[model samples]
Target: MTFPAFVDLLRQLYVNVAEHEFALPDKQQTDSRVSLLTGVHRKEVSRLRGAGAPVRVVPDSVSRTSAIVARWLADPQFVDARGTPLPLARTSEAGEPSFAGLVESVTRDLRPRAVLDDWLDRKLVEIDDEDRIVLMEGAMVPRGDGEVRLYYFARNLGDHAAASVENVLADAPPFLERAVHYDGLSEELARSLEAYSREIAVETLLRLNKYANQAIQNDPGGSSRWNWGVYILTSDATSLVAEETPENKNAGGETA
Candidate 1:
């Protein structure tokens, strides 16, 4: 199957895991995790894995699979559709940020778009979230160190909410070098970020969606209403209102 198609299948598996907390099947199982999740044949899954196609596997079996799906949700390709690579996200050698950390920073700060632009400017990292969910996959490499890689998945918190989360991340602790970034971001980096991000977003969104659905269900009747309308006022909107009534006039009989 095509790479994009494979990525989509992996995404569905991630959603299933997030919604149900589905444990991956053990290696001893007759069917591979991919087949069980996608109804694809185990042999096909094996072939794909051998061919460097990303396959889903148990955490314990990650090393065994040649082409395992990333644990996070970020797409690690630094290049855009036009093949333009984005700027990197690291600020200092000791603070080389992985794609995962960048996502965390964006989520924490709530300014994903700005962060994306910031990443573009650095030309060291690349991010893509055009999908229903945001996926950030990339790598980081300190000048003297090996590459550190990352994968991340984030919910599409609308433009406004994402911006808010980005603001939070900006103030959070920096990503540690020992964690993921060993080399500059690469394709391997993309896979890793995608895997990680998918897992987190799926779990978080499921809970949120459940609560929202429950709220709607509990308020099925038309008894509740909220006032959220916007009103356009005249230029002197505040000045139009008198502070005091005629009965409460000042000693001079002037309105307060």
Candidate 2:
């Protein structure tokens, strides 16, 4: 948290960019470029790059299976009367929606059955007696897959921070930074809010995932990356704290 420590972290980040970011596609990762991009001194960039320092390995892509499960939790068409995700049939029946349909809605390019198999193998979902596919908890959290979790842990946190900064700096229509705060609440209510937040956040992210995937599909070679985030916080010991509900938690889904 100190300035000196922060500077060291920045230097390490510069080394990371120098060593990896341009090594493949650009292959023009000069010390000056790293210095300019990272705001580290040219000499330090060279030193860090030449020292063979162990740079942090950042994960590049999020798990597609996890994204699918998140969508299932968030999408209303995929849920039942109780507001829990319905155990969907593998294949559609008479125009009714199925698990395959749910996956396809988010990612048309990925084969639905392949996605299903991956989810089942990962234990993110389970098949029931009627062959219905039921979604399970921790869809967004990687289980036993340390590498995948690492990738998302870095990528999502980075983007989420970037979005918040952008919103603060923007002149008009801030980039979707909103919340609600309450000062006094019992532990039971706080716990209820936590679970409630997860349900709503999942649904909102799923909606965003669906549209973003579609945009990516439409423009396969787009250079820029797009992302959105949802998170919740609560008081630790009946103290004053703020809570923000990005959207109203509806019975079927969210309305942001």
Candidate 3:
């Protein structure tokens, strides 16, 4: 952020924090009270009061819908021997888990019908003639929804950066943060590798997700949030170049 913009943001933040933190239980939120608490000038506080609150874009944690879908894709009870998600009855039978079971496993506090309706509305799952629900997509990548796409963009990127930072700042054994890079590849080779890597990454993530869920269930300690992701970017060689002229010398200090 530019100097002026950052200063403005800090002022806004002070006002917001003061307004919330110093709020009187029996009385209204007063600018004078906020000014005294936050050390912001009363006039500035009054001016910023008309301004909006500080913007906060935190990573989205796993929702009930996402948890159910992850279990559907990972849990053995929800899949066949071939490792495919089975078309499941709404309710379980004879100790077997079903679609409703999946939802309940994630959250018993919520009504299973609400989850089912949400998935149906999002077109993430389908209903069969017997009222069984079938998985239409393997992953919970949102589609045809601009707002949801933006939400995922913030959530996924924020978590990814946080994980990387955590690994880097670790005192003991750090979590894994590894990547492979290659350049000067033929277009055909690049395409083939991209496809192969995608299949391997997807399968590995699904397998790990299954194991993680089981581990969470078995752990005696309370639960914590965890997430990992795989991504790939491929670009041609020309995108890296900068035009060289008399004003800017080439790599060897020779003008081009």
Candidate 4:
């Protein structure tokens, strides 16, 4: 972010905290109190206060598309024996696992053709030689637009930061936030390990996704919400290297 944008965000955050976390006995959120706590001027606080709380609403298109794709990827009828998504016909008149049925199973509000058209425009899906609709690889991962990608970026990073921060501040760590870091590995070995991790991560995600898909269908009116995500990063170590250990120095003593 540019320095000005960052400052604006920080200022807004401070104002929110002051109003919600440090309210007076009369329940008034005073600008003077916010200015004192956040080092923002009282006048700036008053100006921002008029904007109300920060908006956290997810776009309808993003939420609905994500749900539909999740079900497509996870629902047993939509996948083959090897768990790959099966190419679907346009409607149930063609057969089971038709694209129209797949969409209606999620929500009757959106027409299957509309979703298909959007997906085609976004390159999220393609038509096969037989005229079946086939999901494109990496379709689940957001791409092509800064707005969509940035939404996921903010959500995943924000949740991770929230968990890590809660763990540090709480007397007992209530969140799961753990990682293993090893240095001094040859680039080849590091890449191999990363591949293995990716393999395992995908398997875990698919398993949980299937379970969650069934769960939401069973409890469609449920009020609670949850999120699960995985990430990996690799970079050159700037600090002094330690001796590489092991009987089998390979990734977990195995390969991907």
| Top TM-score hit | 4
| Model 2 agreement with the true structure over 1-256: per-residue lDDT tens digits | 4799656655664466445544547467688877776678889888878765433443322445656665676566776664577889988999877988987876787888887787778787888998888887756567667667545555555555555656666786456766765534577887898899888887776567656545554685855655677768876642335453445222222322
lDDT comparing candidate 1 with the true structure: 0.36
lDDT of 1 by residue, 61-120 (tens): 222110111212222342244322334443323554344344453245434455445445
For each candidate in turn, the TM-score is: 0.19, 0.53, 0.62, 0.77
TM-score, candidate number 1: 0.19
| Best candidate (score: lDDT) | 4
Show where candidate 3 strays beyond 4 Å: 1-62, 93-96, 128-131, 145-148, 163-175, 221-224, 242-256
What TM-score would candidate 2 get against the native?
Answer: 0.53
lDDT tens per residue, model 3, 48-162: 8887553233322235566777788778888888677889888889987787788888887888888778778878889989778988862366666654554565445555555
Judged by lDDT relative to the true structure, which candidate is superior, 1 or 3?
A: 3
Q: How many clashes show up per model?
A: 60, 5, 0, 0
Candidate 2's C-alpha lDDT?
Answer: 0.66
Q: Measured by C-alpha RMSD in angstroms, how accurate is candidate 3?
A: 9.5
**Per-residue lDDT of candidate 4, residues 1-256 (tens digit):** 5898767866776676566545778767678888997788889999988887552447676788888888888999999887788999998764677999999998999989999999999888999999999998768778785556656765565566657756887898987777766656788878997999888988888889988888777685856668888887777664636544574243332111
Q: Which prediction has more favorable TM-score, 1 or 2?
A: 2
How much does candidate 4 score in TM-score?
A: 0.77
Model 1, residue 87: displacement in angstroms?
18
- Tell how far residue 190 is off in model 3, in angstroms: 1.6
Where's the lowest-lDDT run of ten residues in candidate 2? 247-256
Of 1 and 4, the candidate ranking higher by lDDT? 4
